[model samples]
Target chain A: EAAVTQSPRNKVAVTGGKVTLSCNQTNNHNNMYWYRQDTGHGLRLIHYSYGAGSTEKGDIPDGYKASRPSQENFSLILELATPSQTSVYFCASGLWGGANTLYFGAGTRLSVL
Target chain B: AQSVTQPDARVTVSEGASLQLRCKYSYSGTPYLFWYVQYPRQGLQLLLKYYSGDPVVQGVNGFEAEFSKSNSSFHLRKASVHWSDSAVYFCVLSLSNNRIFFGDGTQLVVKP
Candidate 1:
């Protein structure tokens, strides 16, 4: 099974503070994704990377920046955290072709105060 | 625009009853369709996926989904429900570019 690990399971950040959510996958997959889950919007893709040092914007990438320093590490950066950013975030990893089934991490619940 | 839509926001069924969650997509040609289940406080896991071949696709945990290109639908079905099966199910579409789109999701409640 593919293993995706996310750090800081729960976080509280003050308004205007900077926050970073880290994700690491042991499967060595080339594709990694970061998504935010809200009540009605479902899971909106924030950022994704094709491989190391490659980051691409998804549907909703306004306030988020992504870093893929290596094959195993992918990070989501919130330069200026806001109340609207308070939501559960998930990190997933998968290959580029075939079924492209994604393996996900537990999740990180972020609260912006 | 290409998108995925899950009409039912929530569905309640008895533990022993059958279950079906509807999913529809808007796209020109056949795209990769998938059903993902998210347990409480966990990330989404792939339940089933349809790329081509048989319209009826089987997934983990006795779950299955049928794709209808004419109807633009890929509805998930389970013969019998278990209380543990209660979770949020998301319908997803993967375009050729590998950009995935997800629906709002359908929360299934199985009463024991």
Candidate 2:
């Protein structure tokens, strides 16, 4: 089975506070992604990385930034948290940036006040 | 650009009854389709996927999905559902370069 671990299962941040969500994958996948899940919006991609030291903007990258210091680690950063940014975040790793299965992390529930 | 759509937001079914969840896609080329299930407080799990060849593909937990290029749909089906089958189901479309698009998802409720 694929193993993707995310830190800080639940968090509450005040408005304008900085929030960081971390993810680590044991699958040795080359591609990693960060997505946020909302009630009606489902899951929208926030950021993705092809490999170490690479980050790309996703569908909803307005309020988030991503960093990939290594192949196994990916982090999503919220510079200024807001109430609208409150949602569950998920991290995923795939073998490559192609037609492959994605292994997902448990998820992080964030509440911005 | 590729997109996936799940028409139903929620569906309720009794245990041991059959179930079908609708999914539609908007893509010009051949699409890589997938069905994923998410339980409470957990990440999404792949239930099944379809790339090419046979239209019907089997998945874990006795679930299956049929891909219809004619109608641009990939609907999930189960002959008999159990209470454990209750969860959120998402239909996904994978485009080139590993970019994936997901539907809003359909919540399944199974009553015993």
Candidate 3:
């Protein structure tokens, strides 16, 4: 079974504060992704990494940055958090292939006041 | 660009009843379709997927989905509904270059 863990299951931060959401996967997959879930809009990709030291922007990458320092870890960073950024974020990892199945974390709920 | 659409926002069914969730996709070429379920406060889990071969594919928990190339649809179905089957269902499409798109999702509510 694939395991993807996320830290700070719940978080609260003030506006303009810096927030970092961490994720770790034990599947040893080559692809990692960050996504935000909002009501009515579903889940939108924020960022993804192909491997260590490689990060790429997804459809919604504004005000967000990603870091992949190792194959087991991927982090999503918000340099300046805003109330609009308050949402449930999910981390997923999958093997690189034609159509891979992504294993996801429980998700981190962020609240910015 | 590939896209997926789940027509129903929510569905209600009684225990031991039949269930069907509609999903449609838009893609020019061959498309890879998938159905996922997300329980409360949990990550999404793959229910079933269809790439080629048989149009109907079975998944865990007795969930199955049928793919239709003519309609560009992949709808999920189950013979009997249970309380545990209540969850949000998402239909996804996998495009070229490994890019995937998901539908807004349909919430299933089971009543005893």
Candidate 4:
């Protein structure tokens, strides 16, 4: 089984506050992704990284930033939190191809007030 | 650009009843499809995937999906569902660059 761990299972942040969500995977996968789950929007990708020191924008990357300092670590950052950003966030790790399966982290529930 | 669609937002069925969840994708390239299940408070789990060749693919927990290139659909099916099968099901499309797109998802409720 693949192992992907996320920190701070739940968080409550005020408007304009900075928030950081961290993810670590032991799978040694080269690709990592950050996605947010909304009630009607399902899972929308925010950011992704091909490898260490690389980050790319996703479908919804307006208010989020991502860092991939190492192959095993990927982090999502929110510079200014808003109530609209409140949602469950998930991190996934996988190989750099369409045929490979992605392993997901448990998820983080964030509430911005 | 690739996109996935799950028209049904929710579906309810009784225990031991047959189940089918619809999924459609819009992509011009060779499509790689996948079905995933998400329980409460957890991440998504891969139920099955279709790369090529056989259209029908079996997954864990008695779940299966059939890929139809003619219709651009990969619908999920189960002969008989249990209460444990109740969860959110998502259809996904993956690109060669490792970018994956997910449908809005269908919530399954099984009555015992």
Candidate 5:
């Protein structure tokens, strides 16, 4: 089955510390996305990439950076963790440029103290 | 700017009853519509999608949705729901800007 897996399913970080959430997909999709889920917000896009060596900003990309160095891996980085960044992060991949479907990872819960 | 609205935040139903989850969008063009289901503590999965051609699309697990161009609504329905059908239902509309916007989601509780 096609799958997107995220490592460090749970994480706890101190303020000002750096946190990295890694995602890997076996589907060999072209579009990768990072989103955070919180109460009332549903899911907000943090960042996305069209392919390796490309990253684009999303609706809520203010405090996050994304990297897609290879086709199978996409990473979301929090340079200096903040309490507000504590939420469940999900990674998804799609093959289509716009009308394609996204396959999502189980998600990673992050906490910043 | 595009947006999706799922009016009902929560809906409770007894098992074996019919169900409907409403979704409306603010796009003028024919948007790519989709319905996704998220089981408790699980990743979101695509239930069904409507790009064009048909107004009524059938999805996985006996779920179906009707797309109305005049009403700007795509409502999901199931003839009879099962206990396992209890999940968070989300509606998504792919916009011309190459982004997909989702509704707040409807939490369905199916009691046996």
Candidate 6:
């Protein structure tokens, strides 16, 4: 079975604070992604990583950045948090080949107050 | 860019009743289609996917979906739904590079 885990499941930060949400996957997948879930809007991509030392922008990558230091780890960083940046974040890992199968983490609920 | 559209935002059904959730997509060529379910505050679970061959595919929890090339639709169905079936269901489309687009999920409220 594929597994994706994220830390700081629930976070609350003041405006202009820096926050980093961590994710780890056991699938050894080569692709990882960060997304946000909001009401009336589906999962919107924030950032993604092809592999270690490679990060790419997604549909909504303006307020955040991504890091992939190793195969199993991918992180989402908010340099300066704002109230509008508050949303439930999800991390997903996909296999390198064969349809790019994806497995998602439980999710991290973040709040910027 | 490929996109998915789920027309229904909320769907209500009684236990032991047949259910169907509508999903429409806009993409060129043979697009990958997927249906996922998300319980409250939980990650999304893959229900089914269609890449090629059979237009109809079966998934866990007695759920199934049929892909229609003509209609550009992939509708999810369940023979008999239980109370546990209540959740948010999303339809997605992806091709390569591990980037997929999702539609605003359909919230299914199965009343017992």
Against the true structure, what is each candidate's TM-score? 0.98, 0.98, 0.98, 0.98, 0.97, 0.97
| Model with the higher TM-score, candidate 2 or 3 | 3
Name the runs in model 4 displaced over 4 angstroms: none
What TM-score against the true chain A does chain A of each candidate get? 0.98, 0.97, 0.98, 0.98, 0.97, 0.96
Put down candidate 4 lDDT per residue, A5-113, tens digits, no spaces: 9998999999999999999999999999999999999999999998999999998999999999999999999999999999999999999889888889999999999
Model 3: lDDT of residue A19 = 100
Please report, in order, the local distance difference test score of every candidate based on alpha carbons.
0.95, 0.95, 0.95, 0.95, 0.93, 0.91
Which candidate number has the best TM-score?
Answer: 3
The CA lDDT at A64 in model 3 is: 100
Q: What are the candidates' individual DockQ scores? A: 0.67, 0.77, 0.75, 0.86, 0.71, 0.59
Q: What is the C-alpha RMSD of each candidate to the true structure, in Å?
A: 0.9, 0.9, 0.8, 0.9, 1.0, 1.1
In order, what fnat does every candidate score?
0.56, 0.76, 0.67, 0.82, 0.64, 0.44
Task: Give each model's clash number.
Answer: 0, 0, 0, 0, 0, 0
Candidate 6: deviation at residue A9, Å?
Answer: 0.6
lDDT of 3 by residue, B3-98 (tens): 889999999999999999999999988888889999999999999888889999999999999999999899999999999999999998986578
- Model 5 spans with C-alpha error above 4 angstroms: none
lDDT of 5 by residue, A9-84 (tens): 9999999999999999999998899999997889899999999999999999998989999999999999999999
Q: Whole-model lDDT for model 2 versus the true structure?
A: 0.95
Tens-digit lDDT string for candidate 4 (B10-110): 99999999999999999988999999999999999999999998999999999999999889999999999999999999999998867788999999999
Global lDDT of model 6: 0.91
